[model samples]
Each structure stands twice: as C-alpha cells, then as structure tokens.
Target: MTPTLSEVTVGDELPALTVPVTRADLVRYAGASGDFNPIHWNERFATEVGLPDVIAHGMLTMALAGRIVTEWAGDPGAVARYSVRFTRPVVVPDDGVGTEITVTGKVAAINEDGTVKVTITAKAADQAVLGGAQAHVRLP
Candidate 1:
C-alpha cells in the first residue's frame, strides 16, 4: 500500500539497497542510458584519466537511491523532484565486494499541496556517497 503523507515523519529511514557494481553492470548501464563516458566503460581510458577503474555511472547510483524512496512511497510518479551530488566514484571491479547504497530519509517540510520535502542521507558501504540528496514527493 502507498504510504500516506501524514504517515511519514521527520526521521524516517528508508530500507537499504545493495547493488553490485560490476564491469558488466557498468557496460549495461552505459548502453541503457546512452552515457558511454570512457571512465564508465573503458578501463584503459579510465586509468589514463586517473580513475581507479571503469566507474559506474553517477546516474545509476542516483537511480538506486531514487528506487529506495520510490519503493517506500509506493509510486515512482509520486516523486516530484530528486537530486544528488556525486561525492565519490563507484569503481567497478571484476571480483570481490560491491557497493551498497543505504538511504535514510527525513521529512524536511510539508507543502500546502501535501507534498513533502524529503532530505535523504545516502551512503555506499558505510561511506557517505551523496550528501544532501533530496526529493520532493507527493504522498498518497
């Protein structure tokens, strides 16, 4: 069921989403989003550009965070506005551990139209990935 606007509070926490940042994942995201940035698909280019490895698209990580909120709110269209800062690069690896995105949200303000300004704290594997991630959502 969709959550009512009045049901959310100032310190509500959204469930965490763990996504593996693999080389294949980056390649697929690049194709899907039309963001074939070398840093996200070419290891040699990424290394030449001083990145650790082929990095995942920033938008991909942001989309994961958005999923957390949209799932909690029970409707993707309920999200009126969403934004995040790419504080760190999501490096794709051939093996070993992957990244984890955890989203904790708080109601910053309630609008006259029943929309809520949500302030989200997004982290990746315990590191702050996106600071000041926020969304304006109209709850059912």
Candidate 2:
C-alpha cells in the first residue's frame, strides 16, 4: 500500500530489508550487466587486486537499497531521484552462506510539492557500504 503523505513523519523509519548475495547472483549480474570485470567473480584476481574476494556490482547494491523506497511507495515509478556513494565493496566469498546486505531508511523530509526525501543506509556485516545515500519519492 502507498503510504499517504499525511501518514509519514520526518523520523519515520521504513521496514528493514536484508538480502543475501551469493556467487551465483554475482555471475548472473555480470552476465546481465555485461560487466565482465574479473574482480567481481575471480577470487584469485580479486585478491590479487587487493579485494577481499569477489565483489558485487555497485548498481546491484544501489538497486537493492532503492527497493525499500519503491516498495514503501507502492509504485516503482514514484521515485523521483536517487543517489548514493559507494563507500565500500560488498565482498562476496565462495562459501554457500555468502554475504548479507541490510538496508534501512528513514523519512527525512516531506516537501510542500507532495514529495518526500528518504535517507538510506546500506550495510554489510555491520559495516556501512553506501554513504550519503538518499532517495526522493512521491507519496500518495
């Protein structure tokens, strides 16, 4: 359901979302995105390049983070703008457990124009991976 503008407050927090990223997910993303960077899949290459392990694509992480706002708005088209800075790589290991990314959002502001600003924080292993992330959305 779309959250009515009147039902939201500056400090209101959206539901938290946790997503697991596996090696298979990374491979699929690479194929679909045509981002054949070895660092995203080749563990040896990644380690040699100074990465902890295979890393997820930045866009993939951003999309997962944006999903919270789109879902809360009940319409993907409701998003007006979104921006984020990649603060760290989401290192994905070969283990079956992989890594989990957690996303949380808080209502930052309600605009006079029927829009809202949402501040987003995305973390992995209790460490922030996205910084200065925010989303602008239209509410019902």
Best by TM-score: 2
After TM-score superposition, what is the CA distance of residue 8 in candidate 2 from its true location, in Å? 1.0
Model 2: how far residue 40 lies from native, Å: 0.6
lDDT of each: 0.78, 0.93
Clashes of 1: 0
Residue-wise lDDT of candidate 1 within 1-140, one digit each (tens)?
56797787766656655555677777788889899888987789999989987777889988877787788788999999999888987677656554556667777888887788888776765777787789999897
lDDT of candidate 2 over 1-140, digit per residue (tens):
57888899999999988999999999999999999899988999999989888899999999988998988899999999999999999989899989999999999999888899999999998999999999999887
Scanning candidate 1 in windows of ten residues, the lowest lDDT window is 93-102
TM-score of each: 0.87, 0.97
Name the top lDDT candidate.
Answer: 2
Q: Cα deviation in Å at residue 33, candidate 2?
A: 0.8
Instruction: Give the Cα error of residue 5 in candidate 1, in Å.
Output: 1.4
lDDT of 2 at 21: 93
RMSD of 1: 1.9
